[model samples]
Target: MDHREIIQILNEKKKICLLIDASKYATILTNDSFKFEECLRIISKLTSDLRIINKILNKKSPKDKITSLTNILLQLYGCMLALTNGDVSQENSNDKNNIESNSIKFVKGKYGKPLLESSMPIKFSMTTDKLFSSMFLTKGLEDTEVGIDVANVINYCGSNCIDLFRDIFTEQEFNYLSTSPNATTELQKARLFTKYWSFKESYSKYTGEGLNCAFQKVNFGELTIEDDTTIKTYDLHDDIGLVLNFYSKWIDSNRVLTVCYKCSNDHKDNYIVHKRIDLRDVLNYLNGADIFD
Candidate 1:
């Protein structure tokens, strides 16, 4: 489907749905081609709300590249989809004016954390695999951040990579993985490896450091979240107030999906998590239900 068609589908849902599927492209360059095309299609569909973005794109502004511009468009569409009901066409003169007046500029923060202008209250986060990208947006949620990451565990480490990462594991985590009967096989090692990688990526996204933070210093196995329970304190940078929560589903015996969210409030004490088995299933769930539903 074209980008506008996708936006219409999303707008009809009245919620944000960040879809990531990497199987379509071969590498980052090719992935950019596909993603940029999707962005153009989305902007075309958003003709009513494309003033600032279109101006930048049309003028070929030096401050941003075509790829960054495309990312901004995707983020804006996601933010709009999340904040408004299906009636986004009913323009808010204030937001429209903000768009036109340069009151809300899309700019990159340290380590490339894309930020909507400080004046704008919207918050967003995104992550990618070799071929797919995922993004999330929320309104008026304090210290709100959303991170989505996909990794091929086998690709990061050879057969022994899990062992390498395991060396850094906390005692509690090490005892579980090392002694668990499942770790005897290569496939199990790969699964554990991906889980750790996803956790670190999610944590990095939480800190807004991306890859600039030291992964070795942060151990994923030490952190755990049980159903209906949340842990508030963990060893992380002082500047970051992060609540890490994740959902994982096995796509196959070999592939998996893990999503992480960062929030300022204590969601763990009262939050309910919903999960799906695959990308298409996630799309269907998010599209069909209200956030509270």
Candidate 2:
């Protein structure tokens, strides 16, 4: 979809999962299809903050490339919020009149979770594998939480990943993998192990605990995989009064994606909408398209 069309959906739904192909971005940079100077020019029009612009421009490494893409998307998302009269930083409350002030800034939460510098309820989390990356964004209450993780099966399937990461899974989980019919083959075991690992990572990310959380004790309930399907549903264990939902699926033959969040029971059906996006559209938006119209 076009940039404005995507913004319209985000305006209506207030949450979206953007699936991005890292290869496309890599092509753009390596082919010199989009000059670095031109990128800076486009970004400079969005914000006069030279420090932020310079930092983004210096993202040359593989990890830095993903961060750079995230920075661009956040800036565009901030613009959408401004057009839709959504929450924005107090200093930029007048951004409607000065579009350049729409650039986004981030600060660390108590546990080092990246949060918007503004007190706005805008929340986002990102995950990247070798080929693709995904970002989950939502505008909700302060208590809202969302997390995502993606992994390539081939990366783990080559080795005995289950044994290497055995400490992360509970005894029950390990037994399930050992006895389940689905784990009869090495490849099957790898996919199942990667799926469980991604789920645990998603939950840890959701809790803002990251690697500090005790994953083995965080029971994921019963994950019965009778067949190879894209999407699977299961009842997630809950907190005191909070209900958390989880969604996972195979993005393709080799890649798996997982998302965890807090929302109403019924909200799982539509709480977070997924949209596969082209980096070109995002670049166009960053290049100064009128997302409001």
Candidate 3:
């Protein structure tokens, strides 16, 4: 299948792949969102590192948001399996022993972002709305961190969300979200929310701090929600802002996905050369690859 072909290419070129399925996770966890987050909490309980659970506790975020992030973490664990270890299901178990084995271990960075301690140089970021979950993983990235976020253009991301997420945007950005012409129709407003929210989250995860960063200080500059592709040239919160860029696309009527990357003048051209692979390919490779890590 195309997935197998893409995996071969990525493996050769040292590229990355993003995997997303808005509904499968809820199905995997038996449609109980709270149950999944609780499962994550229990696994976090097993880790000697309390940072995973502690960061979630500090967010004081809503149950749904917490659940979404937990799902992404689990999915990211699968990505690691697909890349480094093969035949993931063969070792399936949710017990304490399997917790560390089924999922990859992440140690907290100085700022509380889960830093990958594995030998492979992969960086990932994940985002989830009340309805969907998405993850991004990159291989061959040498010292740079990558972030990603996916949001349903509808759902809880409509005009009604502006006030709820107001604190996350800078003054200029809040004005755009509140007053832009694109903010008129219900669908437009939803698109607006998804656009900024996804980029904000991508930046947050790119920095490895998640929502713990000073989000309001980060600036995405002037942007329209209707842009068709990724927008480069975003800036961080500093007086002398660091270079950041976001690439975005509406994969379907219901979903919009964005990826963030940090590139210096030397590597910018090389990093943007990215590939989007079907999640099915990763699954197929996991099931069929004769060589296991």
Candidate 4:
């Protein structure tokens, strides 16, 4: 479905898809015809918040600044579309650059988890790898937070990958990656390592720990595979009152995607709905075209 349809679903259900593509963004950034200043101007208009615009502009590299701006633009635009019930005419109106300043505020958790300062109960998490970026946004989930991560195992399948990860994994997790019967082949071990690492990262993000939480301390030794759909739940030793429900899948043979969120203490099933957003459509919308119309 198109972004308009997805925004409608987000407005009604408070959950949208897992965004999993960034090639379009890379192309636009790398294309010789693409004007960096022009792209920056569009991002400024879309966000309309000097705080965010200045943050993106202060990055060291042009690519870094543009990429940061683009990602934040997508997030702010998505939140705006949902909050305004898809009435985005202001996005293209003469005062578009003031939209965010007038309507919304962006905040962050203590550990840098981005949050939208809104009356509605909305939580979003985003992560980016080399080729793709993933975002999870949902609304009206009382007392629950979400975190997402994507990793490419192929990059870690090098000769010293096991050695590289030796310090990151706990003893049991190391055994699982190095000598467990479940991971006999080199590629198998790499995939297993990716899963463990992504789980730790997403969990930390969920807790607003960011990189402060030591990966070695977060052990997944007791992690067990569930019966269906590769869904798994792990109880955090650090917090007895919260449960981590993870929905993980292989977007491809070499790439793994994970979404982590909290569930009730009783272990109720909470499944996340995922849809891939079209980067081209997002690009078009950023250019002041109403894809919904």
Best by lDDT: 4
* lDDT tens digits, residue span 127-189, model 1: 544334456544444555655555665465666564676644556666656656655566666
Q: Report the error of model 4 at residue 157, Å.
A: 5.8
Candidate numbers, best lDDT first, in rank order? 4, 2, 3, 1
Point to the candidate with the largest TM-score: 4
Superposed on all Cα atoms, the candidates' RMSDs to the truth, in angstroms, are: 9.1, 5.5, 7.4, 4.7
lDDT digits (tens) for residues 165-191 of candidate 3:
889988898888788875688877787
Better-scoring candidate (TM-score), 1 or 4:
4
Lowest summed lDDT over 10 consecutive residues: which window, candidate 1?
284-293
Summing lDDT over every window of 10 consecutive residues in candidate 2, give the lowest-scoring window: 225-234
Clashes of 4: 2
Determine the C-alpha RMSD for candidate 2 after optimal superposition of all C-alphas. 5.5
Worst 10 residues of 3 by lDDT: 284-293
Q: Which of the two candidates, 3 or 4, achieves a greater TM-score against the reference?
A: 4
Q: How many backbone clashes does candidate 3 have?
A: 2
Compose the digit string of candidate 2's lDDT tens values, residues 1-293. 54444445555565677777756456545556345456656666655557656666576674465556555554454444434443333543333334445555556677877666555567767777654668777664346877888866777744456667778888888778667776777777778777887788987888788999788866665464322233334334453344566677777887777787776433335335677876566655555453212
Model 4's alpha-carbon lDDT is 0.65
lDDT of 3: 0.58
User: What does candidate 4's lDDT look like per residue over 1-293, in tens digits?
Assistant: 35556665665556654564655555456564345556556566654467777776787864565556556656765666555544424353223334545655777788877788877777888777654667777765667888877777867756478677687777888776666777666777677777776787787778778777666766667443221274467666673455667777666777777777766444344455667766556656557553223
